[model samples]
Target: MHKGNFKEMYLNTEQLDLGKFKVATSETLYMTVVSMLFVIIIGLILGLLLYNLGKSKRIGAKIFYNLLSIISNICRSVPFIILIILLIPFTKALMGTFLGAKAAIPSLVISAAPFYGRLVEMAFREVDHGVLEAANSMGANKWELVTKVLIPESLPALISGVTVTVITMIGFTAMAGAIGAGGLGGLAYQEGFMRNRPTITLFATICVLVIVFMVQWLGDWAVKKTDKR
Candidate 1:
């Protein structure tokens, strides 16, 4: 009877170590914010490049899309763990270490950039072609069309795209914990699971859940506020 008491042990905790919980949560939030910033900057550049290249000619545009599609496919094909491992050397060179929040930035950015780029590309694609034509009809230059028409029209979709990117980064940050990257996932893995501390594990899980839900709520609010239609 005593041997089957795992469930009881798991649920016996009254609370978690708040300091560990806070440190882990802050690391996760940092990683997600930095990754999102990189994704936004890189995604915007890629999207603009696609748009510019696509507008040159019918054949050229198809070629551009095909190239981007292939790149995206390749990046997407690599699993995140493998990608992180593969990038460890670069992370070290850039960050002087590859086992903490700073080191995880490149991997997070590399993983999410293609993702957000595609989102941005698709968001821009959703802009009305006729509106673009109308902009051109009004002598809107390329930059003007991009800033005034394309981006504004797709602001809501872009916000949604960022939401998706942030959520994805949260998952990635959890995985980064294996490399001594401090986050709730890492805390759960190292202190809770490995050390047999159920209270710590439960606390970490709850923290992640709260963060994810909060991000989702904020994202929904931003979409509603930005949506023109």
Candidate 2:
């Protein structure tokens, strides 16, 4: 593996930012959690709508579903770095500054939401068709079908998707640091690559890895709990 030319020299440990470890961990967590809330909420709504509309026989519902599908595809297709740059103005407008933890949330959601939205749709699709037919035969209303049948049935899949989306966001959070977003990635960029302090950079990376491991462990537990089948 290429360790890069800078690794040949000793790092200046004194140049490390002492607060970086805490800031990196905090920023990454904050951005990941906050953005995930929005992603799950919006993704759920969009997923349900997409599924219902596509199932409907009405021409208008079909049109709306097609439009929504197109939009989700476009959002998912955009790269995270470009999406963050494009949303910088909006983030600044909303949070008054797009440089820190809060500023990074907007981009993180844009990058994760559509991805999770599709996951939600796929999860919902996995529900047994016989169950949906039974619910409908019993005159279950739209809300009942969605709340009782769709969501509950797909909970396990949603749990798994949440894990994947959150992990992806953590990586994006690091990339956001490249643009002064103030996370472990940013700390690594500044100390490891820019300052050429390899030790500080390596430490910041390990911190990220540990956090990812914890998240994965918890997510796996949740999936196991939710998956009765």
Candidate 3:
């Protein structure tokens, strides 16, 4: 291709409206941030329960742990696109529609939470056993042990894990867009892919990369600040 043609291919904005681009970007951000909040909260709770239950000698706890483990594994194993389709009814019931940015949040949270929950469990596992023992000797109750000891000690890893999870969510947002979720992904699919406008797709991909890079930078900063060791 000639230089002029290449320039036109990328620089042509006649079909790619700036206003729509801005809206798509905002929608993507909204979906990612909102879904991430839920993912973190739910994932943390699931992780804590899994860890505590797995450690208990009680048969009931063990049975519950096994059941939870199976569920988490199934969720993590499902493909994101299939998961979205499977969740359409739930999303519609919850949001009253399954075709917009808001509707995508439920699927995003459900898809990511189990993955993040496993990461949280790993982070909790990495906490120094010696420190836990010390806390136990000091008569730290279960709540205190979790709140003050486990979370604080595993914070760096937790942050790092969340960084990865957030980036994954960013990608999930794009996939959500494919089905009219109204984000960069939708823009890419509808305008770029379906309409044969490669420039728009390229633009959307670039925007996603920028968001991922920013998240990575911020996550690294947070990990460094929190990692006292």
Candidate 4:
């Protein structure tokens, strides 16, 4: 292996455009934020629905739970690269081309929604049954029990779950870059892997690490701040 020169690599500026960095970073951030919003909305609703299913005796809560469990398991089990390719046709059709950040959004949303849905389900499950019963005793409707009691009580866990989802989306975004989406990953691949620029690759790697760590730290602090226990 040819060793990369750290000093030369750090000092080089041939391909280091701060503006492009800003643009790429902005696109990546937008993708993460927007996709996460969709994930939370879809996941939370599905999770609450599943939680209600588990509570009801109508169609055998056990069976409903098992079916959802299986579907979630299938989605979570697929490798991301394969998943991206699997969605390529749909992505191109939906966005007019599967060649950039916009193209990547569909796959990101598809993959993220199911993952966070399972996490949200777990978060909902963690809510105390007594609290739910008390809410019901006070004449709380299903929506009231969900929004007022279940979601509020699970806020800390939900934040933590969002943290996990963000970190995972960072990875997915990187993978999406390999498919022609222009982000740090795509930048790294173009400048480093394909063009033999070790400096760019190293910088991209460090930036991703920093972003992921900062997200986790912020998440931890938020959870701690909100936790009453």
Candidate number with greatest TM-score? 3
lDDT of 1 by residue, 110-217 (tens): 888988888888899889999999999999998899899999999999999898889888988988887777788799999888888887888787888888889999
Q: In candidate 2, which residue pairs clash?
A: none
The predicted structure with the larger TM-score, 1 or 3, is 3
Residue-wise C-alpha lDDT for candidate 4, range 50-116, written one tens digit per residue: 7778777876787987798788777777887788899888988889998888888888877888888
Screening candidate 1 with a backbone cut-off below 3 angstroms (N, C-alpha, C), the clashing residue pairs are none
TM-score of 3: 0.96
Query: Best to worst by TM-score, what's the order?
Result: 3, 4, 1, 2
RMSD (CA, Å), each prediction:
2.3, 2.8, 1.2, 2.1
What are the runs in model 3 whose C-alpha is more than 4 Å off?
none
Q: Pairing residues by index, what is the TM-score of model 1?
A: 0.91
Q: Which model is ahead, 1 or 4, in terms of lDDT? A: 1
What is the alpha-carbon lDDT of model 4 when measured against the actual structure? 0.83
> Candidate 2 — worst ten consecutive residues by lDDT sum?
1-10
lDDT of 3 by residue, 130-181 (tens): 9999999999999999999999999999999899999999999999999979
The 10-residue segment of model 4 with minimum total lDDT is 1-10
